[model samples]
Target: MLEDLLLQGAQPNYADNIRAIAARWEALIPPARLGDLESGDLQAGIVSILESGEVTDDVILTIAGDLASLSWWRGPPLRDDHRARLNALTRARLTRLADSLEMAPRKLPRSQLRRSHVLLVGNLLDPLHSPSGGAIDYAAALASDTAVSRVEIVHSGEVLPAMRTYIEARLGGFPASRGVALVSTRDNPDFLADILSRGPCTFHVWCEPALSPAISLVSRLGPTLMFTCADEAPVQFADVYWYFQSEAHIEKVWKAHAAPQEFIDRYVRILALPSPEPRPLEPMSRASIGLPEDAFVIATVGNRLGVEMDEAYITGIELALRSQPKAVWMVVGGLPDYLLGAFEQVLGDRFLHVPFSRELDRLMTTVDLFANPFRAGGGNSANIAVGAGAAVLSLSRGDVSSLVPDSFIASDPEEYFRYLGFLMDSPELLAAVKAEQGQHNARMRDQGLFLKEIQGLVRLAADRYEARGCGAPLSTTVFAPLTRLAQAG
Candidate 1:
């Protein structure tokens, strides 16, 4: 019997290996007779051969289960159990595989990404599913470009227990491969170890201003690329030709001195939503949210999160409520806690809160009026706000006011209340304003060509990487003054 020879220690795949011989015979023998094989010379042969090779009882039990049920060869039928086993096996093999293959991890060159794999590192302004997470959205577009072969992401914002936990969370259940690397800020030295010892490439993508010790590590690592969107001047960081829903922002950047003359000369990009045939405003839906049947709806969405210059948002809301007792104010998007707390103390009962939704295009249909109480920030959310067919009452904060024209710009609560109340009281005025907005929205739709310009900037980054290899770290010092010039200009 093979058991005698297995006792002399033969490898599993060898002809003399009792385990292989038992497997061969077990497959040949009938299912009902497999029970007999378990106890007789055949079974003993398998056990003695397995024991000689130091295979545990677990192995023999597995073989027995396979012969009995004919399912062991296929792994656990339940997906979760199967996946867990797979992950365990993968982890067990990684170190041995690395050692046996002598596959040393490669470092990302400091200069450029040309043919190298690039990992986008940043906090998702919205989850991956949201259309607005520009990082992911742009990355998806870049996937079709041949310049990139591999794109991995390291979402460090999702806090985890350790570097391993962080990597595991981000790996999103994919098996690790040699082409992917974790782009991290240096605060995670252990992650750095994991990279140098086991990774294929590494780079740090700095997403914020204000250098932290973590980012300084990128400077030490020679070939890292640092990118940030926090430049004071929009054109300094973004292409001047980017698509804007509002021409006001596009023009503002064009006039700003911080933008390169080269950019200004060719800045014709503006992305506009398609303009569908206009329709009459849908019937008032206020009755659904507990607004009185007679109450008029006035809605607004903007940087209600917080801005020291714009503390009059709550004041404007109170003014609207006082001016029109039957007015229901629906606010969408994030609101600052302090403002919310204050509003709750004053007019919380009269206000309805709806978090920001991509469905704004549809939700705008139900509103009767839109009031923008922004007292600061020159760039307005009015473009899209107006696109929804709502007449806007905005603060004429410099160039941002051009986002909506023939609209009231109120400096105080009294002025805000006056225009908002007038619009509600006069249906004729509201109708005229809404009609004008429809025309403007159509004009804006023509600006959709601007998105290609944004794509052009990304392409520029990709091309530079290819031509020069990863080059020296750009001088962060030079961009600071440029941002200041943009603000003054």
Candidate 2:
């Protein structure tokens, strides 16, 4: 079946398969770096395996499992018994593969790089899963705009240089004809340096860990802007970008991460969009849900990255269920397997663990309230979905619940219970809140303010280019309105 699928031109899960294979074939060097193994330097191990006719999912998994079973230690030297076992096995396997491979090296262009008016630098290297929904929305709108000429995005995540080069070369054919191409983080410093050397504008949209480095680098480079979600002490630089802070909490950098007062004075804008047609309520089918109909349905969505288990989330659900004993907790973004036993021991039958599904709209509509008991991660956790009219309950701290009204902040279990009680007891209040939330969400969709913000940033970058005489050409049409606004003064 799998072979037939492959023959039909289905994309193989190549990278994931390679990682496992590398771990198994740990021959003194990292298996991942095996692509560097030189049989006269013409062919890499990964290339050899892929080109080999005998390749199958089962074969690869078996090979990787065998390799993994033999090793315990990581890094360069092999002193321990486990390391020796892994190293000996790995070398033998690679030698066998090298003897079998008859193909010669293929030469390719380094990268068919293009330049863009907007250079967006992201810390996320994995193209498939970097830059969250918000970032992608911003990128799509900026690139799609008829006014803007070009956009180049780069990404990296444990990917090989050959793969990175290949993807970037393919990116040369991406849309946005007038714009220049910018580099995403491709793990190759030479590639990054090349773009920086050639490009006129750069904007680093950073999340948490990226904040400090982004700030430092932008300051050093002289023509860069750092936009971050971190709330630490702000670094003085050319400009800072912030979002509309909800009344729930405050950050230290609110005042610090700022552009010059002159820049602020230079532009003023207003936004108003036509009302969108209303969407109707989706019907709830109880049997479709596993839990009892009377049960309080607590739902949460997350990536499962942070250290804290969002036990406070468990507590929130428990509290709600206490008020209504039949309550069942439906969780998306599956919990860690290790913690599953513990969660079962505690929450027992109440916990319903479900893998993260793309059909979130249906799930959100089905749940009583969308709970985001996040202790970590950047940006407003549930804002986008909640804006789409998914009833949300989240932490008052940080960006997650910021846009939520004061009435929505659940500092303690008791406060949460009261709110939950109020929600259940008063259908009118629930309907009104959902309606208001829907309106706010509609505003978000209509404004496309983030795109305009990026445009503004691009203009700032262009002015910097002009000052430096970089002459990196940009779209005059996009910024024409701003120019007019200035001249009208």
Instruction: State every prediction's TM-score relative to the real structure.
Output: 0.45, 0.56
The candidate scoring highest on TM-score is 2
Evaluated at residue 91, the lDDT of candidate 2 is 26
Query: What global local distance difference test value does model 1 have?
Result: 0.43
| Stretches of model 1 off by over 4 angstroms after superposition | 1-121, 125-132, 141-154, 159-231, 234-284, 300-311, 332-350, 353-365, 375-391, 396-422, 432-451, 458-489
- Expressed as tens digits, the lDDT of each residue in 1-489 for candidate 1 is 423432232211132334554666555444555554445654343334433433433343344333222111111121323322322222222212222322222334433343333433444443322222333433333333444444444445543334344334433343333234444544454554444453233243433321122232332232333332211122112212333324444445334423434334333333332222234544436566556667677776643233322446666667768777778887766655555677667776678777666556556656777776553322324544566667777665432354455467666567767777778889898898788875765665442332344344444543333333232222222123333322332
Candidate 1 has its poorest 10 consecutive residues by lDDT at: 69-78
Residue range 18-52, candidate 2, lDDT tens digits: 34544445443334444444332212243345324
Give the runs in model 2 whose Cα sits over 4 Å from its true position: 1-116, 119-133, 158-175, 180-188, 196-199, 208-215, 218-222, 230-238, 246-286, 292-295, 309-313, 337-339, 345-348, 374-381, 411-414, 457-489
